[model samples]
Target chain A: MEKADHLSMKDEPEVQGEPTKTAVHLSTKDRPKVPGEPTKTGTSMVDTAAAAVQSFAPLNQIHQHLCAFHFYAYDMTRQVEAHHFCSHINEDMRQCLIYDGPDPNARLIGLEYMVTEKLFMTLPDDEKKLWHTHEWEVKGGFLFMPGVPEVMQRQDLEKVAKTYGKVFHFWQVELGHELPIGLPNLMMAVTRDGQLYPEMIKETEKQFGISIEKERESRAYMKGPEHGIHPLANGGGKGLKLELREVDIKPVESVPRVFV
Target chain B: MASSGDEDQVPPGDPVTVSTLVIDAGTKIMQRRLPVKQMNTHVSTFAIYGGDMSRQIETHHYIHRVNDEFLQCAVFASDHSDAPLIGIEYVISDRLYENLPQDEQKLWHSHAYEVKSGSWAYPRLPEVVASPELKNIAKTYGKFWCTWQIDRGDKLPMGAPELMMSPQGVGQGVLRPELVKRRDEKYNISTDELKQRRAEIAEPEWINPMADYWKQHGKCFVLDIVTVEMNRNEKFP
Candidate 1:
């Protein structure tokens, strides 16, 4: 694969003497007449050099390594709905684009981020409270990597099952609001079975044409010890121990403002 | 006035107590007439952009909540009560960050590392208040661009907006000692000591890939016309 070739070639000394593309806009006639003088045109030598650096093949490898996955998420606070298309920046982090629906014209709702368990554990206890673990989401078959081979999907779930996600919903579209309004509400993943309404899951299953039971069966081997905890017991399973402390400050008048 | 050479120490005393008035419903309560609503005030420091990177400026962030979507923080350089307003930083949830256009998204920086590593802190606020605030801030992203390069000795804000980024994976030597010394004297806190305290804050194995964009691409000054103009004006060629 071209990606594999790029990775393998990373350690090798860069091959020199490659033909460099010159800016066609700057002809020989436009070159500085004097040896040490500046070019007459508005474009400086720095601009030319910057354009060269941008076209370098090595830098593009970083962009090429990105991978995408699909997931269904519900707001932890309210019964608001969301679907996510996450792009993995690396093995450690993924940035997801949340959409109201799976359709092309779906309103972009918010963003979610997933990080490895190692990274999640490094967060401060309070910050840790904001994140929801993926154990139940993966094992219960709520999260899926759509359009991949079953085996590959299983492998992806195995890795994802060990990660934690931080999500926020800007637009409360479920409330029939066309625009994003209010302070961004912190959204958490439904880590337990009963945490999410059964009807929502059924609706999602119907829309995706997949059975959650079958998904769970396919990913059964990926289940770890963490999933053994009963969802209803112990504050909704192993990793869902987040409790937001109440702020005692009085609510003041709402500030009038305009968002750029 | 505290100088860079001063060895300032934080006074050993109890935490200051704040008192609030209790008003009974039968008593008349006085209220001030205001045209607009008030915003929560937050204080922090930012290492300024300029010569040798030796300047740290105190900033007061007046945060205006725009519903549940985002907060717009008007950042002012708080050298005095009536300090000069430097810039505005719009903070949005990661959800909003994702909805932003690809090019627009590149401008925002994640605060997870900043808060967790203790690089960004609230010096005045109690730990209890600050910790939860940081926890909420951790989930969001900020787009901060300063028009003024005060540390560089710019009397007024000039040129295009220069993006402000959080310091990450930066060592003690990377910071200008004189600036740190001055800021330490003013705040009665040591950057070296803070760095030592935060030494155990392990960096996450996975960081947002774009977080390092400035570090990687910032060295290429040839792309910026302002740099070229400055270099030409200074006869650096």
Candidate 2:
């Protein structure tokens, strides 16, 4: 909520010129570049920056934070690797991180939580099949179901860790521990349209015992993985100047309770 | 005011001899007499081109004929665009000038004809040929080709004849007496009907059928070169 407030303040006067917008672009591009860069013309510079940063890290990293903090998507591992890997590296970063096929387990993990019938139907076949099976009869016919328990399933956690990395990353300045101004609300607001409004964020936070905040007293520069938010330092590459502060927002708030 | 040693100084005749006269396409323009002063703003100037004398006379007479029929008809207003006048220049010997009709010859010196406005519309030439209106104009004037102005903001009517006419900036003209007479004789329509028909016929989609027909045959319709040259001279299509 505080983050959204700060962002509105920041964005209000930002429309005066292209400098702040350009800042976002340059910030995202603070990475090594790769060969055969796609041309950027007429496209908003912000998209280019986000794309550049996505290339620096694995899609699993982005996916992990996104799922942990917001809605869950099944079969995200293959999709992330296939569609997102090594796509946004600046030319210099391309020299450093070649798009070689490396073991993804070292950097990521996948989660396999129980989903509702509605949620199961919402997912594709490959994703829905990742759970257990059950059978029951409804009005017109007998229904065969992939039975997933209501509680935070063990296999789901394992899957999450396997696909997205074990340590999810968020950003903090060199020694500071608080979540930066807009990032936390930004994380809460990431599902689709814009940021979640203040009321929704509060309601969701109260319903889920999880805390996305980092402890002020902690001396560690990186937020510990147990905190469910990883902190990583970004920036410092050619053609990029400002350092980026990022946090991985994961999807842990909506696990169903298993009665068994 | 001749100097003391200027006994042999003779007045220079027309700069170029009529027999050897040569004027490139950009030098002359034809303007229909209208209250054009209303259109010019501080930045906007009517484009004027050097045109042949007789064509200029016809254009001017055409304006007078229209004004006499439809007193106070607002036709070519300059207020819509910022482009300056642009067209060609021609040097006609007195012999050619005398051959023109008495009424047209009288129009040569009246407000019915406006001299070149010294305005340049664009840096490059127009690529499209003479306008359909001009082709029809040529038909009325008994000539194969002549210049005409498309009213400001109005495009040329499609299916215009192949006549040597340069596309000028947007221009509109009141209905001339001959045109009104012809309309009454041919279709029994009024000036209002003509205006409505003109608007309906100038849609951009009107050219699609021609384009599609050409595409079906795996061939393309190319504009005439003379029209292209006229556009090049007028800096308009």
Candidate 3:
């Protein structure tokens, strides 16, 4: 089986055929001459000028190899609703989009993070306190990659279960508001059963039409020595003791903004 | 349907987005010959200090290769399409920052305040996407230098490479609102609101020791021809 290509050029070269001399004559007659500029003949000259302008068009460069994953996150401050569709940025760093629903017109509500254990371990002890491990999300079947085969999903989950993520929601879609309002609030995933409103997860499962019990059962293979939490994860570190709490840190709302 | 075990059965494009035709990772795509302007999401504006420390030049940075061991950012005068390229800031991981010699390390600045304070943000992206990028950026240290002082109205890059650094503390009045206002007007966010949000993020106790050394020393030395010439004249006179 051939592997799928990830980076194929979208543009194909244009084939040049015979150029008519009549077209060149007509173009020269129609073109307005600029003051003190030499009159140009030949379609080749015109084509070169057109090509020069075309070269200036914005070229889209593939900056990084990207892959997408889905996530289920709940607001840490509110702790009522679970948002869906969190995506990752380079497969290693998780960047999830918080949408209102599964529909195409779903409102983009917030963003979340999933970092590899390797990256998470390097964060300072203070920063680590802001992030949460995916153990409960994985073990409880609350988090699962959608659309992929069960085998592939299991493989992805094994990698995901070993990582940590931080979530922040700018739009609180759960309050029945039509638009995202207020400042961005830091969000958290349920690290334990009964921590979040159980009904919210059930509602999310119903909306997505997936059973958490079955998802959890399928991910049983991800358990064991390979998926154990990193020491630095869950706010645990050498010589530093910190407890994860649901405190609202409002001072972050004051960070100065600059237009980019 | 073909068995999932067959790798070829997995289609040629991304399963989610059908319009985007992709080559397999194994296929080598030609590097873009044309100068490509990719929109780097995590772009932040910095008031870089010069070698003399009195000169503060505003710079816009578009960060790339962020997930890699070394993060690279292209400095621009503005976020506009025609914004001139002024410089580059190369950030390395703490592991790499630690290995640099004392003299070399003095050039880099700690991102703890920049990240924690919300000074560094994804310019045009939604909050959901920008937050994690900022989180990832907080972990690294950057060494920035600007060749073009676009703020000073130099049509082209002139003079020696000026040392660049992020603001050390919040509300230090280091970041100019006039410059930040132009950026906020472009992005549709108030700089005051961002300043308010930044205050909530706790400052990290552990900062890059290199940044600490430079802070105490109160000067950044850049080897430049202009400085050498001036020093030579002083010695000769």
Task: Identify the runs in model 1 with alpha carbons over 4 angstroms from their true place.
Answer: A1-77, A225-260, B1-237
- Residue B122 lDDT in candidate 1: 50
TM-score of 2: 0.15
Write the number of the candidate with greater lDDT, choosing between 1 and 2: 1
Worst 10 residues of 3 chain A by lDDT: A20-29
lDDT of 3 by residue, A100-194 (tens): 43333333344455566666655665566546677667767876443334554555567667777765444334333322222233444545555
Off by over 4 Å in 3: A1-260, B1-31, B34-39, B52-54, B170-173, B195-202, B212-214, B226-237
Docking class of 1: incorrect
True contacts kept of each: 0.00, 0.00, 0.00
Q: How well is candidate 2 docked (DockQ)?
A: 0.00
TM accuracy, model 1: 0.36
> Residue A114 CA error for candidate 3 (Å)?
43
In terms of lDDT, the best-performing candidate is 3
Cα error of candidate 1 at position A33, Å: 59
Lowest lDDT 10-residue stretch of candidate 1 chain B: B228-237
Model 3, B1-237: lDDT tens per residue? Answer: 000112231111123222112321211142221112222333645654534333445456644342344544555555443344455566666666666666557667788766665556555555443444454456667766565555554432333345566766633225655555655666676656665665545555467666633455444455322111110101110
Judged by TM-score relative to the true structure, which candidate is superior, 1 or 3?
3
- Interface CA root-mean-square deviation for model 1: 30.0
